[model samples]
Target: MAEPSNSGGSIVSGVAGRYASALFELAQETGAIDAVAADLSTFEALLAESEDLRRLVGSPVFSAEEQMSAITAILAAAKIGGVAANFIKLVASKRRLFLLPAMIRGYRALVAQAKGIVSARVSVAEAPSEALLAEIRTAIAQAAGAEIDLEVKVDPALIGGLVVRVGSRMIDASLRTKLNSIRLAMKEVR
Candidate 1:
C-alpha cells in the first residue's frame, strides 16, 4: 500500500508521520483500521502502566529479532489481531519501536479526519449527568458540524464547572481558571 501523502498538512510531518502514514494506509487497505486503533489503545495503556516496557522499547541495544520476539509475544498474549501483531514486528525490525506512541496518535488523527468526527475532551470536578453529557455533545456537534466523540475526565482541582477542549480550541470555564483570572484582575487593579 502506498503511503498517503500528508504533504503540507497539519500532521506534524516527521519520522512519526512516515510510520503513521504507512500504518494508516496499510490499515485502510486491509480493512483493519478499527482493530489497529484498538490494538494501539492497548499498547498505549501498557506504555502508561509499565516503565519496563517503555524502557525495553526505547532500548537501542536490543536486537531487531529480540525486540520483534518480545513485542510479538506481548501482543499475542494480549490477544491483539494479526495485523497489529505484524505491524509491531515491522516496527521492531526497523528499530523504530520508540516511535510507536507518536505513530498511534497520528494514526488516530488520520482516522478521525477520515471518519469526519471530532473529539471533545471534557474535564470537570465531578462526573456530569448523562443528560448533561448528551447536551454538551449536541452543542459541540452543532458547533463543529461533525459528530463529536466525547471523552470525559474528572479533575477535582477544577473545583467546579468544566473545561472543554476540542482540537486546539479550549473552553476554560473551570472555577480554578476563573479564580486565577479574578486574582490576576485584582492584582492589576491594585
Candidate 2:
C-alpha cells in the first residue's frame, strides 16, 4: 500500500477532512455513497499501482486544467460516474488531488460509521489462509462487539506471527518483536 498522506485510517482532519466531509454529504444526499466509495477505492488502488498516475495527481508540475482533463478521461475510461465522477473532477480542478487518497479514506470512515462496522488493520508475516482470516475476523468481531471490516497485509520483515491494531489497541505477536526481546535479553546478560 502507498504511504498514507496523513494519520491513520480515515481519521479525516484539517483540509482533507473538510473535503471529505463535503464529498460525504454530497454522496449521502444523492444516495451515491456506495458508488462513490467504490470508485474512490478503485482510484486509490490505481494511485498505488501506477507511479505515473500518482505523480500526475500529486505533482505540481501539471496545471489544474491538465490534471482535470486527464483525470476526467481516466475516470470515464474506468466507468466511474455520478457524484463520484463529478466530485473528483471538481477536486482535481481545484488542485486537491494530492489529498484525494485521504479524502477517500475519510469517506470510507463515514460509510463504515453509518453501517456500524469497525475497520481494523492487521499485518502478518505472509498472506494469511482463508481459515486463519476467518478466525481472526471472528475474534475481532467478538472483541469489538461489532462487525469486522478487516484490512489485512503481509510484511515479510515480521518473519512470523501477526500484528493487529484495532484503533489505539495493538497486539504485536510478530517474530521481529520476539527477536528484539531476545536481543535485549542477551545484551543485559552479564
Candidate 3:
C-alpha cells in the first residue's frame, strides 16, 4: 500500500470516530473494551453475511423503541456481553443504528492505534507461506512505524502478485495491472 499521509492524524477522526470514541470511552470506563470489540466483530460479521440485517439497521421505518427491542434481542441471541448489549441499546435509542458498522470500524482503528498497531489488507492470488506473511507484516510495520495486523484475502482475478491496502493508501502490484499496462504499451507501439 502507498504510505498514509503524515497529516492524517489518528486514523479514525470523523463522524464515525465521534461515535466510536464515545463507545470506546464507555468500554474503557466499564473495563470492557475486549468484550465490546468481540461484540462488534460479531456484528461486523453479521453485516457482512446478512443483507437482511444490514437493511434492518439502515431502515428508517423502524421506531427507536422497535429498533432497540430488535437489537437487544439480536445481541441476546448472539450472547454479547452486558456492556456491548447496553451500548447497542444506546445506539438504537438514538436512532444511530445505521452507523454501527462505521462506528465499529472506527473503534477498531482507535484500538489498534492505541495499541501501537496498524491494520493492513493484503490481497493475493493465493495464500502466502507463513514466513512470507511474517516478512510482509514486518515490512509493513517498519514502513508504518507501528505493529502490524494483517488481513489477507485471495483474489484469483489478480492472476499473480499482491495488492496491499493500508487505510486510504493502496499498493497495486497485481499481474492484472501489469498486463493492462503491457497491452497499452503494445497498442502504442503499433
Candidate 4:
C-alpha cells in the first residue's frame, strides 16, 4: 500500500503518528498490513475491556521494565504476534504505552486512507442494533459516495439520536444538542 501523505493536521504526523507511520511502512513492506491491523484491533478491544490493562498502558508510575513485562505477557496470551506485537512491545519498553490508543487510531486512519475508505465516527445515546448500524452505514456511504469504516461510540450523555463525524465535517443531531438549541432560542425570544 502507498503511504498516505502527511499533510497539515494529518493523522500520520505526530509522535503517535510517527510510530504508526513506521509500523505502517513496515507492514506494507512485509505484506502484513491486514494482519497488523487485526492484531492492533484485538489489543484495542482488550484495552477497552479491562481497567487493569488501561491502567497499565496509561500510568507513568510503572517502570519501563514492569510495563514491558506485563504487556509482553498480555500480548503473548492474546496471541498477538508479528509486527504489531513488536511495535507494542517497543512502545512499552520506551515507556510510551500511554500513547497506544492514539497510535492505533493513527494506524487505522492510514489503513483506511490506503484502502480508499472513509473513516466516520458515530456517537449515539446507546448501542445501536445491527440493523441501525447498517442503516447508518448505508446513509453515510451514500453521502460519501465511497466505502466507509464506521466507529460507533455509545455516549449516554447524548440522551438520544446520534452525531456523525466524517473527517473535518461533523453533523450534530444528538438530542442533547437539539435541546440546547431549543433552550437558546427560547431565551432569545424572552
Scored by lDDT, the top model is 4
- Residue 54 local lDDT, model 1: 92
Clashing residue pairs for model 2 = none
> What TM-score would each prediction reach against the true structure?
0.84, 0.86, 0.81, 0.82
| Model 3 agreement with the true structure over 73-189: per-residue lDDT tens digits | 788888886777787788889898988888888888767766767789999999899999999899888888888889999999999999999867899999999999999999999
Ranking of predictions according to lDDT: 4, 2, 1, 3
Q: Model 4, 2-68: lDDT tens per residue?
A: 4577464455777999899998999999999999999999999999999999999999899999999
- The TM-score obtained by model 1 is 0.84
lDDT of each: 0.85, 0.86, 0.83, 0.93
Best-matching candidate per TM-score: 2
lDDT of 1 by residue, 1-190 (tens): 3333345455646888778887888889889999999998998888899888898799898888988888888888788866777877888889999888888888888888778778899999999999998998898899888988789999999999999999889999999999999999999998
**Candidate 1 backbone clash number:** 0
Please provide, for model 2 over 113-162, each residue's C-alpha lDDT reduced to its tens digit, 9 standing for 90 to 100: 77787889999999988999999999989998999799999899999999
The number of clashing residue pairs in model 3 is 1
TM-score ranking of the models: 2, 1, 4, 3
- Which RMSD values do the candidates have, in order? 2.7, 5.3, 4.5, 2.7
